[model samples]
Target: MVNLQVCSFNMVGILFLLSLILPTISGDCTCDANTEEKHNSAALHYKLGAIASILLSSVAGVCLPMLGKKIPALRPENDFFFVIKALAAGVILATGFIHILPDSFADLTSPCLNQNPWGNFPFSGFFAMVSAIATLMVDAYATGYYTRLHFNKQANAGELEGGANENDGHVHVHTHAVHGHAHGAVIPTESMTLPELTRHRIIAQVLELGIVFHSVIIGIDMGASQSVSTIRPLVAALSFHQFFEGIGLGGCISQAKFETKSAAIMATFFSLTTPLGAVIGIGISSTYNENSPTSLIVEGTFNGLASGILIYMALVDLLAADFMNPRLQNNFKLQLWVNAALLLGAGCMSLLAKWA
Candidate 1:
C-alpha cells in the first residue's frame, strides 16, 4: 500500500512538472513575427475529430493486450506472444530512430535559431547521444539498485528463518508438482524471480514515460497547426501511430504483471496523454509559435531526449533481452519469424513518418 501511494505521488509529481514546463516552453515568443495565422472552422472540426479518433484508437490499442489475458493463445507463455512483442519492439525502435530523431534534427537545425552554437554544432546528435547514455545509466542503476535490495531482503528473511532449519548449509529447493502425476521434477525458481519481475515493472514505467513525452509533443504540434490539409492526413496517420505505439506500451505493461489498479493507472495514463496534449495545444494555439527560437530549442531538446529513451528501451531492454532469451535462441524458425515481424513493424511505422 505504501509503495502504491508513493508511486501514485510520483506520477502526480511528473504530471505536475510536465504541466508547468510544457506551457512555459510553448508560450508566445517575440522571435518570430511573421507567423502564419490560418485558423478556420474546418480545421477546428478536424482537430476536434482527431482528438476523439486518436483517443479511441489509443484506448483500443492499449486495451487489446490487457483483454487478451482471456484468450488462451495470447497468454505470455505462448509463442505468438513473443512474435507480438517483437513487432511492438520494432515499432518502438523505428519510432525512435526514424521518426523522432529526424524531427529533432530539423528542429535543432532550423534557421530561426541564432547561428552561433546551434548552427555550428550538431546539437541534435550530441543531445541524443548524451540522452542515450543517460538512459543507459538510469537503466543500469535502477535495475542494480532494485536487484540488490530484493536479494538483501531475501537474505535477511533466510537469516531470520535459519534457527528453524535442521542444517545451516541445506538450501531449500522448490519443485513443481502435478496433482495427477506420481512424481514431479525439481524446477529452479530463477524463471520468474522477484527481481526479474521488478525489472520488468521498471522497464514498463520508464518506457511509458518516454512514449508519453513524445506523444504529448506530437499532440501539441497537431493541435496548434491550422492547415486543414496538414491536419487531415495527420489525423489518420497519428491515429495509427497512437494505436501501434499503444500496443507496444501495452505489451510492456502487460508483461510487468502489475496489480489491477496499477495496470489501469498505466493504461489510462497512456491513453489520455496525447489527447490531453492536443487539448493543451488547442488552448495555446493562438499564442504558441512553433518556429520561434525558444520553441525550437525546447521541442528539439525534448525530442532528442525522448528519442534516446525510446531507443535505449527498445534496443537494450526489449529487443536484446527477448532476442537473447533461451527459448528464442534455441528455436531457429521462431527467430526468423520474429525478425521478419520486426522488419514489418519497423517498415509500417517508417512509412507513417512520411505523413505524420
Candidate 2:
C-alpha cells in the first residue's frame, strides 16, 4: 500500500509538472491555418470507410486467439503457439521503438515550441525514460503483492488442516510428502499456477492501456485531417496496424484465461477504442487543430508514456520471459524458429510505419 501510494504520488507530480511547462513553452509553434480551413467531401467518405475496416480488423485479430481453445494447433500447449506470441511481441516492440517514440520526439521538439525549455531539453526522451521506470515499478510491485497473497492463503489453508488432524498428524504429514512430490513432478508441464495466471491478467490489462492510448491519438488525427489522399492510405495501413496489434494483445488475453464475459468485455473495449476516437474526432474536426501547442504537448506526453510502457512490456515481460523459459532454452530448433518469427513480425510493423 505504501509503495502504491508513492507510485501514485509520483505520477501526479509528473503530470503536474508537464501541465505547468506545456503552456508556458508554446514557443513559436502555430497550427497550420491553411490546412485547417480546407474541406474535402471525399475525405469524409474515406474516414467512414476507415471506421468500418479498422473495427472489423481489430475484432477479427483479437478474437482469433480466443478461438484457440477450439483448435488443437492453436492451443497454448502447442509449440506453434509460442511462435505466434513471439511474433506479436516483436510487433509490439517495433511499435514502441519505431512508430510511437519517433512521433513523441517530433511533437515535443517541434520548432513551434519555445527554445528555452522545449528546445533546450529532450523532454521526449526524459518522459519516455521516466515512464519506463514507472512501468517496471508497477510490474514488480504487483507481481510481488499477488505472490505474497497467494502464499498467505496457502498458509491459512495449512493452518486449518493442521487443526483438524491432530490425531492423524503423522499420517497426514506422510501423505502430504507424497502429494508434494507428485505436484512438483507435474509443475513443469502443467498450466500456469494461480499467481502466474493473475500476473498475466495484469499484464494484458496494462498492455491494452498502452496500446489504446496511442490508437486513440492516431485515430483522432486521421479523422481530423482534410486530405482524401492522406486518409485513404492511412485507412488501410491503420487497419493492418490494429489487426496485428490486436493479435499480440489477444494472445496475452487468451493466456490469462479470463471468463467468457470478462474476455468479451476486454475484446470489445479494445476493438472500439480506435473507432470511438475517430468518431470523437469527426465531431470535433471543424474546431480541432492537431498542430496547436496544447494538442502537441498533450499528445506528445501521452505518446511518450505509452511508448515506454510498451517497450518495457515487450522487452521484459514478453520476450525475456519466453526466451528464458526452460522449454525454449533446451530446444535449439524451436528457438531458431521463434527468432525468425520475431524478426518477421518486427519487419512487418516497421514497414507499416511508412504510412501509418
Winning candidate number (TM-score): 1
lDDT of 1 by residue, 1-356 (tens): 11445655665564455445555654344554445557567888999999999999999888877766687665566788788878888888999999998999998888777789899998888877887898787767877776675456446656766776645423431111122112211111234665566677778878887887688788888887777877989889888878877888887777777767778988998898888888877777776778777768878987888898899989998889889999999999999999998998899989988888
- Local distance difference test values of all predictions, in order: 0.76, 0.76
Ten-residue stretch with the least lDDT total in model 2: 180-189
Candidate 1 wrongly placed segments (more than 4 Å): 1-39, 166-191
For every model shown, what is its TM-score relative to the native structure?
0.86, 0.83
lDDT of 2 by residue, 1-356 (tens): 12223433443354344334433432344644435344568888999999999999999988887889797777776788889889988889999999999999998887656677888988888888998898888777877786676556446556767767666665554465456434321111157775577567778777877887787778777877787767888888888878878888888888877657666867887898788777766766766766677778888988898899899889987889889989999999999999999999999989988887
After superposition, the stretches of candidate 2 with alpha carbons farther than 4 Å from their true spots are 1-39, 166-190
Q: After superposition, how far is residue 255 of candidate 2 from its true place, in Å?
A: 1.0
